[model samples]
Target: NLGSPDERPALYRERSPVEHAANLDCPLLVVHGVNDRRVPVGQARLYRDRLRGLGYEAGEDGDFEYVELGAEGHASSDIDQKIRLFRVLGDFLDRRLG
Candidate 1:
């Protein structure tokens, strides 16, 4: 664990991906589970918003992609969910590195 944000504000600020969105130099893929309790879905949304604020669009044709799985939390257990995640990852890699 990274520790509490309130207890270690500077560490959190320094380690936050959103805080360093300007340093991104390649395609990014952010996948998050809607039911994630360890790291809430809002964090992913915030990161996407931050990237957008910095003029980076999100999608297959954009600089990044954000995928939210409805019935997942922290990790995937269902077969369909796993397949979907792999497909998304594969597509992103193919588009970026093919």
Candidate 2:
């Protein structure tokens, strides 16, 4: 009862318990592999976008973050990229969760 008819149930499930706000108290960060095949990076991005729109840091109303590693897939097999990835992740955590 909350959207255009074109929306399928499964697709809408993630948006359930809908939230619409411009500011929230919490924050979040998400690191994802661009080449992920199982859940697809799109889904994670979708979640981030939704949250961002609502004002949660993890969402639009807040400080939500999404990191996509290129040529890394689900796991960073490349040593160089892996090291950089860890450094970025570490920085993100230190700055956000520190």
Candidate 3:
């Protein structure tokens, strides 16, 4: 509505490559905060969906991982996760990539 399709062709052209590069078949870890206000969690979710659509694994058993830290706000700025979460993530990655 803001801009016609033709008016945004350049925008699409510039972003397509980044999206395509992200969709490659490889291991991906996406860690985020549920309360992040800067970048909506849905954006990460959409990216995960796109990567999954591109034939990447995206599940507990897949190459893609999504972790949502609760009440952590946008970043780990000062609110770090409890030790258990770190242990869980470390163990997960160790088992997966190790």
Winner by TM-score = 1
lDDT of 3 by residue, 5-41 (tens): 4889776756653366464666566777778898777
Candidate 2: where is the Cα deviation over 4 Å? 1-25, 57-62
Quick one: ranking by lDDT, best first? 1, 3, 2
- By lDDT, who's the top model here? 1
TM-score of each: 0.94, 0.62, 0.63
Point out the worst 10-residue segment of candidate 3 by lDDT. 16-25
After best superposition, candidate 1 residue 98: deviation in angstroms?
Answer: 1.3
> Which stretches in model 1 have alpha-carbon errors above 4 Å?
none
Better structure of 1 and 2 per lDDT? 1
Model 1 lDDT vs. the true structure? Answer: 0.94
Candidates 1 and 3: which is better by lDDT? 1
What do the candidate models score in CA lDDT, each in turn? Answer: 0.94, 0.65, 0.69
Worst 10 residues of 2 by lDDT: 16-25
Q: Write candidate 2's Cα lDDT for 1-98 as tens digits.
A: 66653777655655543333234344555778888886578877776677666645542334766677776577767899889888877877677677
lDDT of 3: 0.69
